[model samples]
Target: MIMMDEIVLFNPGDSIGNFHDYHEAVQTAQIYQERHTESGHVVVVKSDNGAPSFDIFLAEQQLDNGQKNPSTSKRYTISKKL
Candidate 1:
């Protein structure tokens, strides 16, 4: 399988966007955060490191009836404040 690194803008049940470029994703996340004060958002990066991507987690959660198991995929959050 081909592994492509990606940045995903996540908000629990909703996903804002996915970006291949880090800077663009960060800028977009920051802008979204600035516009939505009460909403919680996080910027997640897909990497080789052993962490679950927010997007993948969401999909898995849906299949598992809201259960979370981190060992299934690889991703890490860059910023929860952005």
Candidate 2:
């Protein structure tokens, strides 16, 4: 298998967009999430080995239980630089 970092934008209807650049993927996700506020889309960034580095979600959602609440989405940061 080819080894490289990956970014995926998970949109409504379980549709996904694959990307190699994390920032680009995140931007796309943000745009989609903003445009489709009712869709509840999310973004995932992974390392070369498939370990998740970042999980971006719609606002007012919980990361632990995958539940929606009034709190902002939780963010995980592996490093200062992407």
Q: Give TM-scores for every candidate, taking all chains together and pairing residue i with residue i.
A: 0.44, 0.39
Worst 10 residues of 1 by lDDT: 56-65
lDDT of 2 at 62: 23
lDDT of all predictions, in order shown?
0.44, 0.44
Please write out the lDDT profile of model 1 over residues 3-80, one tens digit for every residue. 554433323433566556666666676776677766654444443344433222222122222336434423344433
Q: Which pairs of residues collide in model 2?
A: none
Candidate RMSDs in Å, in order, are: 9.4, 10.4
- Total clashing pairs for each candidate: 1, 0
14-80 per-residue lDDT for model 2 (tens digits)? 2245456677667777777678778663544343345444334443332444536414433333211
Residue 50 lDDT in candidate 2: 54
Q: After superposition on all CA atoms, how large is the RMSD of candidate 1?
A: 9.4
- On the 0 to 100 scale, the lDDT of residue 4 in model 1 is 50
